[model samples]
Target: MPTQNPRVNVVLDNFLYQNVRLLAEKDNVSLSAKVRDLLKEALEIQEDIALSAFAEKREKSWNDSETLTHDDVWS
Candidate 1:
Protein backbone atom coordinates (compact mmCIF):
# COMPACT_ATOMS: atom_id res chain seq x y z
CA MET A 1 0.00 0.00 0.00
CA PRO A 2 1.07 3.56 -0.75
CA THR A 3 0.31 6.72 1.19
CA GLN A 4 -1.24 9.67 -0.59
CA ASN A 5 0.21 12.32 1.79
CA PRO A 6 3.47 14.02 1.05
CA ARG A 7 6.54 12.44 2.56
CA VAL A 8 9.63 14.01 4.11
CA ASN A 9 12.90 12.38 5.17
CA VAL A 10 14.90 13.91 8.00
CA VAL A 11 18.21 12.86 9.48
CA LEU A 12 18.55 13.19 13.25
CA ASP A 13 21.61 12.67 15.44
CA ASN A 14 21.58 9.82 17.97
CA PHE A 15 20.60 12.00 20.91
CA LEU A 16 17.72 13.72 19.11
CA TYR A 17 16.58 10.41 17.62
CA GLN A 18 16.44 8.78 21.02
CA ASN A 19 14.52 11.72 22.48
CA VAL A 20 11.97 11.64 19.66
CA ARG A 21 11.60 7.89 20.00
CA LEU A 22 11.00 8.16 23.73
CA LEU A 23 8.39 10.86 23.24
CA ALA A 24 6.63 8.76 20.63
CA GLU A 25 6.58 5.76 22.93
CA LYS A 26 5.23 7.82 25.80
CA ASP A 27 2.46 9.23 23.59
CA ASN A 28 1.73 5.82 22.00
CA VAL A 29 2.31 7.24 18.50
CA SER A 30 4.76 6.62 15.69
CA LEU A 31 7.97 8.67 15.40
CA SER A 32 6.68 10.38 12.28
CA ALA A 33 3.52 11.58 14.05
CA LYS A 34 5.57 12.89 16.97
CA VAL A 35 7.90 14.80 14.69
CA ARG A 36 4.99 16.24 12.74
CA ASP A 37 3.30 17.44 15.92
CA LEU A 38 6.51 18.98 17.25
CA LEU A 39 7.15 20.75 13.96
CA LYS A 40 3.61 22.14 13.97
CA GLU A 41 4.04 23.46 17.51
CA ALA A 42 7.37 25.07 16.63
CA LEU A 43 5.85 26.78 13.62
CA GLU A 44 2.98 28.14 15.71
CA ILE A 45 5.42 29.56 18.22
CA GLN A 46 7.42 31.17 15.45
CA GLU A 47 4.27 32.76 14.04
CA ASP A 48 3.31 34.13 17.46
CA ILE A 49 6.78 35.64 17.91
CA ALA A 50 6.63 37.30 14.52
CA LEU A 51 3.16 38.70 15.17
CA SER A 52 4.24 40.10 18.54
CA ALA A 53 7.21 41.87 16.98
CA PHE A 54 5.00 43.37 14.29
CA ALA A 55 2.51 44.60 16.90
CA GLU A 56 5.31 46.18 18.95
CA LYS A 57 6.62 48.01 15.93
CA ARG A 58 3.14 49.30 15.14
CA GLU A 59 2.62 50.36 18.74
CA LYS A 60 5.82 52.42 18.66
CA SER A 61 4.33 54.51 15.81
CA TRP A 62 0.78 54.70 17.22
CA ASN A 63 -0.92 58.08 17.76
CA ASP A 64 -4.23 58.71 19.51
CA SER A 65 -4.97 61.80 17.37
CA GLU A 66 -4.69 59.79 14.13
CA THR A 67 -6.95 56.98 15.29
CA LEU A 68 -10.74 56.49 14.95
CA THR A 69 -13.23 55.82 17.74
CA HIS A 70 -15.45 52.75 17.93
CA ASP A 71 -18.58 54.80 17.17
CA ASP A 72 -16.87 56.44 14.20
CA VAL A 73 -15.95 53.06 12.79
CA TRP A 74 -19.47 51.72 13.29
CA SER A 75 -21.15 54.69 11.62
Candidate 2:
Protein backbone atom coordinates (compact mmCIF):
# COMPACT_ATOMS: atom_id res chain seq x y z
CA MET A 1 0.00 0.00 0.00
CA PRO A 2 1.24 3.45 -0.90
CA THR A 3 0.38 6.64 0.87
CA GLN A 4 -1.55 9.36 -0.93
CA ASN A 5 0.98 11.91 0.32
CA PRO A 6 4.54 10.83 0.91
CA ARG A 7 6.88 12.92 3.06
CA VAL A 8 9.67 12.71 0.52
CA ASN A 9 10.52 11.20 -2.83
CA VAL A 10 14.07 11.07 -4.12
CA VAL A 11 15.44 9.65 -7.32
CA LEU A 12 18.88 8.11 -7.16
CA ASP A 13 21.08 6.86 -9.95
CA ASN A 14 21.38 3.15 -10.53
CA PHE A 15 24.72 2.93 -8.71
CA LEU A 16 23.47 4.82 -5.69
CA TYR A 17 20.29 2.79 -5.53
CA GLN A 18 22.24 -0.42 -5.82
CA ASN A 19 24.47 0.49 -2.88
CA VAL A 20 21.55 1.57 -0.73
CA ARG A 21 19.64 -1.58 -1.59
CA LEU A 22 22.56 -3.79 -0.72
CA LEU A 23 23.10 -2.10 2.64
CA ALA A 24 19.40 -2.21 3.46
CA GLU A 25 19.23 -5.89 2.65
CA LYS A 26 22.32 -6.61 4.74
CA ASP A 27 20.72 -4.82 7.69
CA ASN A 28 17.42 -6.66 7.10
CA VAL A 29 15.55 -3.41 6.77
CA SER A 30 13.43 -1.80 4.10
CA LEU A 31 14.77 0.91 1.80
CA SER A 32 12.17 3.31 3.21
CA ALA A 33 13.50 2.72 6.71
CA LYS A 34 17.07 3.45 5.59
CA VAL A 35 16.00 6.70 3.99
CA ARG A 36 14.00 7.66 7.06
CA ASP A 37 17.02 7.01 9.27
CA LEU A 38 19.19 9.15 7.00
CA LEU A 39 16.65 11.96 7.15
CA LYS A 40 16.56 11.75 10.94
CA GLU A 41 20.35 11.88 11.13
CA ALA A 42 20.44 14.95 8.84
CA LEU A 43 17.89 16.71 11.04
CA GLU A 44 19.93 15.92 14.16
CA ILE A 45 23.09 17.33 12.52
CA GLN A 46 21.24 20.53 11.63
CA GLU A 47 20.02 20.89 15.20
CA ASP A 48 23.53 20.31 16.52
CA ILE A 49 24.90 23.07 14.26
CA ALA A 50 22.20 25.48 15.45
CA LEU A 51 22.90 24.65 19.08
CA SER A 52 26.66 25.12 18.58
CA ALA A 53 26.10 28.55 17.03
CA PHE A 54 23.87 29.61 19.95
CA ALA A 55 26.44 28.41 22.49
CA GLU A 56 29.23 30.28 20.69
CA LYS A 57 27.20 33.49 20.76
CA ARG A 58 26.65 33.17 24.50
CA GLU A 59 30.32 32.47 25.16
CA LYS A 60 31.34 35.58 23.19
CA SER A 61 28.92 37.70 25.23
CA TRP A 62 30.36 36.33 28.47
CA ASN A 63 33.94 36.94 27.36
CA ASP A 64 33.11 40.51 26.28
CA SER A 65 31.61 41.30 29.70
CA GLU A 66 34.86 40.42 31.48
CA THR A 67 37.81 42.75 30.81
CA LEU A 68 40.17 41.52 33.52
CA THR A 69 43.64 40.37 32.50
CA HIS A 70 45.93 37.75 34.00
CA ASP A 71 47.94 40.55 35.73
CA ASP A 72 44.77 41.70 37.56
CA VAL A 73 43.81 38.10 38.23
CA TRP A 74 41.41 37.93 41.26
CA SER A 75 41.37 41.66 41.92
- Against the true structure, what is every candidate's RMSD? 0.9, 6.3
lDDT to native, each model: 0.99, 0.87
Q: Which stretches of candidate 1 lie over 4 Å from their true place?
A: none
Tens digits of per-residue lDDT, candidate 1, 1-75, equal 999999999999999999999999999999999999999999999999999999999999999999999999998
The model with the greatest TM-score is 1
TM-score on alpha carbons, each prediction = 0.93, 0.67
Clashes of each: 0, 0
Single out the weakest 10-residue window by summed lDDT for candidate 1.
Answer: 66-75
Where does candidate 2 clash, by residue pair?
none
Tens digits of lDDT, candidate 2, 1-75: 877866767999999899889888989999999878777899999999999999999887886457788788967
